[model samples]
Target chain A: MLFKGIAASHGIAIGPAFLLKVEELRHARRTLIDSSESEEEILRFRDAIISVKHDLENIADSMGDVVEGRQILEFLLLLLQDPTIKKEVENKIRCDKVNAEYAVSSTLLDVMDKFNIMKDPYIRERVADVKDVGRRIIEKLTGTEKDALNNLKQPVVLVARDLDPSETAGLKPGQVLAFVTDMGGKTSHTTILARALGIPAVVGLQKITVEIHPQDLIIVDGIHGCVIVNPTEKELSYYAEIREQFQEAESLLQQANPGPALTEDGVRYELAANIELPHEVEMVKSLAADGIGLFRTEFLRLIQEKGENEEDHFDIYNKMALDMLPKPVIIRTYDMGGDKFRTGLNSAREANPFLGYRAVRIGLDRPEEFSIQLRAILRASIHGNIKLMFPMVTHVEQLRSLLDLIKLVKNDLRVKAIPFDENMQVGIMVETPATVIALDLMLPYVDFVSIGTNDLTQYTLAVDRGNPKVAYLYDSFHPAVLRQIDTVVRLCHAQQKWVGVCGSMAANPLAVPLLIGFGVDELSVAPSLIPDVKKMIAVVTTHAAREMAEKSLSIETGLRVRALVHSYVIGKYPEILLDENDWKTGG
Target chain B: MIEKKITVPNKLGIHARPAALIVRAAVEFDCDVWVESPADKVNAKSIMGVMTLAASGGTLITVSAQGDQEETAVETVVEVIRSGFGEEMI
Candidate 1:
């Protein structure tokens, strides 16, 4: 059997599936007599609740000062003590004469259903908390729970519906070979934890937990976002050979540590990782990414609260800065609003949200909101290398105001006796054609510019990449977008302002050459793509890349440019680019 | 019952940490405390209830409690929001 999923972490793990079964509380209404049995069942339920409380208390106590762990336990404790739930359960037991477990489960399900109807993801996710505590109570009442994964006899490919943070905390690389989940995105807790732990993982398999039996032989190809189960001898040997070679290549890449990724002409280039979370600093450091090219600060808002406070942002930023000490971390301020407000924050439902107020627009309009982020980044810069970048910047004047706001924030920080890097380099994303046209006027405002080609392509071609009809037209390789990037890079270089690219184009195997040829000082790719991109850069010379760039620019369509550049790359290194199609499918 | 309407000032607006802190505070008083948004009301002492509120920054919520310490309960919660849950969020 074979299954495909979202590639989360990179590597291969061949091991037996260790199913982490979620003990879902099945609510089969148990009939209770209105006399002695009812009273006894209620007593039993009380005992179970007491036991659950004790369990949570123990867990909480064990965690000590671990904030998230303690918070979860505290929530569970509150749930157990919630008067409404207790009243609902008692009412069901008394009025309907149902068993204690049934009453508890049914009442919990009612709340879960209520939460389910909510359109807000934050509210919807609360259903999981209800379910978790419900399951705990049910487990106590029924006494039919599986042992925790910590009891596993050997290292195995952990398969689950979704590994919660607690479950993920228990999994060590020595105990768990890999993680495969039925549901999760690349940034899910399981995936993030796996990446930080250097464990290969594949998520969003949909039903891997249902199909996979305990101890079944499985091959988790994290690089491909697929898993093969109970493979035939031929398939097994083929994969086994690939796995061995992969290990060899991994160590070779690690050993090759060719610092700075210089071309044959000794032109040094910085390769950084585009990180969404601070936890990914581990992967970034291990992969030898020169720094974090793009830190999606929007995730900081999503994971915590909508427009999370400066303290939370500061703590995360400070830790990341210290963790990657001396390695530059370019934090992009909330590139949210428009179609991608995950928290259902309607920044006004405009028909054309893509062109609507977001990013630097939000910053310019809400300086009060933007100042907090600016202050946090500024304060965090004292720890280590931290560069701040604004996103969706289209106008030079707006860029000027945003920079001026940062200056005010710095003055405010000083007045308050807060120490920060007085000269933290601020930059703006060159993704809009307006910025491209105003390149000469824009270069002097900041230290550096990172061309976010993903948006630049969308805005340049006037096509939504998500729209299937015109999605094909959304190409970073398009002559105009490339020329825009080309213009920005040239003008930035001419002005002595270093330019990096943190977009899909940075990691695209074909676009890599053109980006290099265009004299992009830095390439900030997805952390997983770092090694492969490094390998591609190792053999190719600046002269060859420049020639590829010049030729591809002369080409008309993105398709032709892609074909030309990829052919040049393929011709340069035939062995490495193999199975490029079979790699992870999406973001 | 003592009741007062206060704005959620913290940027995250009653997320996990705030919810936990609120729950902790709500339980400290001898009151049947409840928090009401425009649409619905939930027990202030319940973490799940507070989280389910899904109150983002600048949303208004009314705190009501009925007990001997109802006055204190409402005031303490109001203070927590005012204090930005012990952080300089405001």
Candidate 2:
């Protein structure tokens, strides 16, 4: 049998299955003839709570001083001791004559229901924490809980309905051959942990746990997002070869050149990183990135209370600048609105939020709010090299007003006698067809431009990538999108301004050559992909890339264009396309 | 009994961390502590009760306590919430 899932991590694993089953606590309710039985039930509930508390304490102690681990454990421990939950659970046991497990589960249901209806999205998310605490108590009551993964006698393809953080925390590298889950997406904790451990994983399988027996032979093909249970001998031999090639690729990538990416013909291209949090600067530095090409400021919403204050922005930006000194840090001002941050007026009612009031529009309308960020960025400019950019600018008028706002912010700093970089570079994101056509007018006022290809594709094709019905139409490699990119590059080069592609397209191994061929000065990608992208850049020559881009430009369809690029890349670097994970099978 | 009205200073309002901080302080005194949002009131010693209060940033709440050291209990609990749970105030 074959099961398809999301290719969360890249690799393959073939081993007997190890199902991490979540024990269900099914208890029968019994009526108490005397008050003694009620007292006994209440005591049993207290004992379970105490045991769970010890379990949590042991876990927390093992975690040491990691702030997030400590905070999570602290929340769980507090929930375990919450007086309201304790009182309600005891009341149910005594009044309704239900077993300890039922009373605890039912009472938690009421608390979670109350939290589910909360107006604040953050509070609503905490319902998971409530559920987690309840599960621990029930497990203790039923005495059917243990870390099954910890007792693995041999490496196997671990299968589960879902692996929560607590279950995955004890996982060490090489402990399991692979992780296959019935739930999760690319950004889920399971995906993140699997990638971090360099383990092969396939998530969103829906029902792989039920299909496979306890010791069934399973082949987890994470690269293609599929799992084969009890493969034929012929299929096993074929995968064995592919697995060897993938291992060779993994080793090659490990030994890849850590220096700056330069073409064989000696042309250098800046390979930078796009980071969301301030602490991620460390990872960017470790990857030997050219600089931070895109520092998304949207994560600041988590602390929106302090986000409005100028000092809060200055402190974070100032530290980032100081740490990456000499290397340019391009901080994109708050890209709020849309699905994220619907806190403003009437955004919730918009039919087309992606095209509606968002990004620079919100920034321009609320100058008082906008200037606070501008003033902070300008003030932090002197601490280190800091470049400012605005997102979602469609016409020249928006560019003009944004430039005007920056000038006003600069003058405010001047009057206050605050030190700032007088020559800080300002750029704009060319994300829409209107911005691409008006690129000439906008380029003259800005120092540089970053093509946000993700938005450009959506806007260019008139399709929302999030909407599944027409998502197939949203392709960055379409002839129209490629032509637009060529025009933007040509326009920027004519004016001596450097252009960078800082979208998902920049990270694509196939798209790198075409972007370099277009004479794009920079390619800012995710921190993890910096090494792989840079390696690809090193193998391709400017002359060959130019030729490839020329041929790709005339290609009629995105699929054909992809095929052309694939052929060229497969010949140049077959290993780059192959998957990377452990070769657990001794070759 | 003693009571005092104070505004939640932290931008995130009384989230789990802030709720935990309030409960930790409330449990320190030998008194019955209670917090009252505009819509509801709950025992300050109960983490769930304080969290379910749903008081966001800039919300006005009343903290009250009775029994031994009632004034100290109300004042201490009120101070913790007003302190923004050590997070930066807006």
Candidate 3:
């Protein structure tokens, strides 16, 4: 049976599968004898660990440039220094006459068992890492070797619940046709590695392990989130046709690059990219973005260590701004709340964290802290076209308070004679229902506003998007959500403030017409989706979009509004319907 | 011995990491270090002592150290305060 899952990495191939099962561990409860043989065994085990360490260092030295290789080195170092492992070995040496090899193996098994039984998926995956390291050590100690996939002459599709960083590095790109995982997300290490390797992959397939059989003749369409298992002749023929069409479409899109994002009727739309990390600057450059629409600054502050101070933050912001110089980079100041900052920020423990002290609110509550960030932002503004934006503003007073704080910092800088761009444009994210409704009050205060549709939809619909049970209520096309977006867009445009949308919906082909119709100045989407969204925008007419936007805003029900907008767009542009089909089928 | 009272301007009080950053800065001077919050006082260099204060953002505390470097320690701690303990959120 065909199984569908989220496509994390893109590509396609057919190959035999190799399954690496978790090893069962048996503990050596017997006390070590003080005999000479036991002492010799201890010496052997110690030598084996030393050899394993040497092997790890060798691998690191050989593949030092690769991220996976670096990660293996990091894991090996952590294992070598783990106190528990040391304590276990010391106990065996003191109590049992067993050799070091047996003692180390026993300790490794204990650690693997402890990690394997963990309920957290992230922690549980560490068992695989432990095993990978332990296997190397055991091999070195026992001098017993088994063929480690080196003998598999045929190309194989690797299937796993998830591949640890170390395991992923050992995978030979030439021999591995594709990757299929039962669990992962877009940001998973496995997904990132697969994408980097340019191998086709599908992840978050909760049932892939149970459903897929050995050598099932599976076809994985990573782009479309479809997997075909034991396909019939008809399905096989259909997929071949689709594969050809997709290749042609991709080549056409490639040719269309570095061109104006203009419709056939000569309407131009600014295509921008939303970025979460500084590393994604390359992606923006590759996509040829007009600018970065929403540079989420929270990532810099969310590292495992202490949150970045003003200086560290300034360095990052300055680097990104200068790297993407000449292009207007709108950075949304730390939007830490919900699931994103739950563990990272100590202040994010409130019952209703989404509506609690976060974003500009946190900044306002603590002016000293707020000033540090403002100073960094204002300082970075001089390096490039750095525009500051506040997220989750529910009231006009909040914006006023935030603006006042910025002004104070600016004045302080002025007094201190620190050079700064006093005219740096400020903006607020129109994400909440309160903010959208109070657009008139908010319009005159900020230089610009970006509609963060993801949160706006969730807030307007009163739904917690992360909760799967209430996910159905998180529709962006719902009439109320559309109306809110339309209201803010219209208000911002009337006030002469260039309004943009930075959200998942902005990149959605179906929503492009409505956004354009609402007269949004810019549509910022994920860097990867820019070409497709631009392609759709090129086919759509501004006037038709405006009409559809009006109709959508007037509707009361989300389903009705969605149907009306979808039908109108499809009826006016038949090519869109075809694109929609292709999109659904992973075309 | 010199003692100067100062409020924690940073949002997350003298937490372990920030406390460590503060301790590193404080130990640069030769002085006996102690940070006293409203509830208790702790050795500025002791990570456990600093954490016990449970000082959060905006909590006022006094920093005192005794020795020849007392003046330098106090000045350094005050600088951290003035800089909001280098925390993004004060």
Candidate 4:
């Protein structure tokens, strides 16, 4: 059986399935204890708490600097030490004459209920922590404590409904071949960890947990987001060869220089990284990126319950600017809405969210909130090279109003005697078709423009990329999308403004040549893709790439454009393609 | 008894970490400390009590204390809550 899902992390893994089921704690029901036995019941609960704490401390000691894991353990430890929980449970054991396990479970359930009713989603999520603590205590009391994740005897393909960050953190390297979860998206925590660890992952399978059985043979194709169950002998050999080739390609890419990103014919372009968080700055440095092409600010909003304040934004941008000194860090303002976060003020479901209020629309609608970010970016500008970029600008008026707002913010900073870079370059992302057609008008107000191909493709083709039914229509290589990018790049160049592509297109092996051929000043991709992109750049000549791009634009469809680039690249750099068969089918 | 009014400071409010910090801070003084929100009041020295207050980022709350070091306890507990629990703040 073959199942498809979102290709979260890239690779292939073949192993026996290890189905992770969330087991409910089984503890004795409420039994009236003898009045004389109340003391013993209380003592039992205390002993169980102590044992759970000790076990958690052991896990914490072994977990070195995994932030999410440490937080979980710390929370659990604190909950155990909570005077109210212990007092409440002991009171129940004594006054209600209930058994120790029953008292503990009941008390913890009350706490979980309180958390569940909390208006704040972040607080509500804490019910998981309470449940975890309760399970550990109940298990300790019943002598049923089982460390399922740690007892893995061999490598297996881990399948689950969905993995919490704590569970993913408990994963021992090389013990799990891949992660196939029934829930999660491209930016889910599991996906992020899988990428960081270079493990194959396929998420949002919806029914994989129900379909998969323990010890069943499974093949996880992270590259194509496919899972093959109980594969035939011929299929096994086929994947084995592909997996070997993938590993070979990865090692080869790793050996390549991080880069000057110069084409064979002497065209130099900056190769940068698009990072979502501050920690990824380290990865960006290791890759020796020219700079950060896109520093997504949405993650901060998503993490912080009340949305990030100016100080939070300033601290991050300041540190990032200081760290990547001399290299530019283009921080894109929070691109919220549209499958991302909905503003606290207006979270009502939009019929067409992608086409509705989002990004710059939210910024303009809430100037007070938008200015907080603008203030932080301007303040951080003095620390290091930091550039501000706005997302989803569809018209000259939006650009004009945004520029006007910036001027007001700058004046406000001046009045307050705050030190900021007066000359900080401000730019906007050209992702809308309206912006692409009106590039000449918008160019005069901005310092530079970065073509965001992902949204551009979605908007240009009128396809919601996240909707499975229309996802097939979402392709950045489409001639219509390609023509808009070419036009934007040409307009930016004609006006002597810098231009770069920061979307997935920048990292795609097939799209790299066409972008380079379009004379993109920079290519900012995920840090892991930098080496691979640089290798591709070294093998392609500007003269030939330009010819390919020209031919690609004249092509009628995205498939042919892709085919044109694919054949051109394979002929020039055959090693870059995983294999002829995989490339031919557009894997 | 001494009482002081303050707002929850952290962006995430009194979640587990902040509640733990508040409880840790409250247990230091030789006095009874209690925090009262619009909905409920809880023992400042109890992590569960502090968390159950469910005081979101901007919710105003009152911290009151009695017994030895009453003034200092109220001030310290109120200060901790006001400090945004050392979380990311302006």
lDDT of each: 0.78, 0.80, 0.69, 0.81
In model 3, which regions exceed 4 Å deviation? Answer: A6-224, A227-248, A303-306, A347-351, A565-587, B1-90
DockQ category of candidate 2: acceptable
- Fnat values, one per model, are 0.41, 0.56, 0.00, 0.71
Question: Of the candidates shown, which would achieve the greatest DockQ relative to the real structure?
Answer: 2
What are the per-residue Cα lDDT tens digits for candidate 3 across A469-564?
455456777778787877887788788999999876786667788899888899887665677777878878888888888877777766666566
Which segments of candidate 4 are over 4 A away from where they belong? A6-8, A13-199, A203-206, A212-219, A228-249, A578-587, B1-90
How many clashes show up in model 2? 0
CAPRI verdict (incorrect, acceptable, medium, high) for model 4: acceptable
lDDT string, candidate 1, B35-74, tens digits: 8888779999877688778787889999999988889999
Please give the distance, in angstroms, between residue A465's alpha carbon in candidate 1 and its true position after superposition: 5.9
Docking class of 3: incorrect
Candidate 1 local lDDT, A511-576, one digit each (tens): 777788899999987776677778777767888888988887788777677667667667767776
* Candidate 2 lDDT (Cα, 0 to 1): 0.80
Evaluation by TM-score, superior candidate among 2 and 3: 2
Model 2, span A1-587: residue lDDT tens: 78887676778888888766534432333456667878887887898889999999999999987989988898888889988889998988888877677788878888999999988777788899998988888777655323546766788787877665535545655678888988765434466556545567898777777677666898888788889999999889988888888778776764576788888787878999887667678878877889999998865654555448878888999999998988999999987665444554444577777878899898888889889999989999996599999999988898899999999988888999999999999999988999999899889899999999877887898876544345446677888899999999999999999999988678676788899988889999777677788878887889989998999899888777777777777788876653221111100
* DockQ, ranked from best to worst: 2, 4, 1, 3
TM-score of the second chain, cand. 1: 0.92
Candidate 4 lDDT, A186-233, residue by residue in tens: 545566567655689998787887677667899999988899999999
**Ranked by lDDT, top first:** 4, 2, 1, 3
Q: After superposition, how far is residue A90 of candidate 1 from its true place, in Å?
A: 16
